[model samples]
Target: MSNSKLYKGSLTTIILKLLNEHDKMYGYEITQKVKELTKGELKITEGALYPALHKLEAEGLLDVEVAKVDNRLRKYYKLTETGTKETVNKLEELAEYIKTMQALVNPKLA
Candidate 1:
């Protein structure tokens, strides 16, 4: 989560947004993609990532598929129908949050 506590709250939203962009992704791939996207500024730990993924799966927002690759079973996650819709809603909410924070942090000069 880098050096900021801010990323913790948005972890689930981040996962959903990534899943929304790609068809499906495994755990490691997701982590690498995040690091790549953030240019190593943000790092998602396994401890944090797995729980969020489980929670999303439990909530019926995500579906998982297990496949054997190189004698190891890997779980791939993809958004459910509800998840796809939720992604859009979550993104909108995040956008609004950013806008509010920007207003507070960089208020217009009067």
Candidate 2:
């Protein structure tokens, strides 16, 4: 599902889930990690990513840390306490969504 609209709604949840697993990550790193995890099936663009990050930060769901790396400053994002709690909620919601989708997509199997 490369650049599929279906995944767009879950982007924030995906970001939260990744941060929950990794502790912290920079923007580019997040993009690359997603691609790696999905085996190139998904590619998250800068346009989609930054806005989501900014929104999450504004909502107090994330903390930002800046460190100089090889003469360049890199901003890393990590979940705040609220964010950690939110990750659980988001994941549960995703699971419910997946179940609903599965039931709809394959009635017999569900």
Best by TM-score: 2
Off by over 4 Å in 2: 1-3
Flag clash pairs in model 2. Answer: none
In candidate 2, position 36 carries an lDDT of 98
Across 3-100, the per-residue lDDT of candidate 1 in tens digits comes to: 65888888999999999999899999999999999998999988999999999999999999999999999999999999999999999999989989
How many residue pairs clash in each candidate at the backbone level?
Answer: 0, 0
Q: Candidate 2 lDDT, tens digit per residue, 1-110?
A: 64479899999999999999999999999999999999989988889999999999999999999999999999999999999999999999999999999999999978
Q: Go through the candidates in order and give each one's C-alpha lDDT.
A: 0.93, 0.96
**Which model scores highest in lDDT?**
2
* Least well predicted 10-residue stretch by lDDT in candidate 2: 1-10
- In angstroms, how far off is 105's CA in candidate 1? 0.5
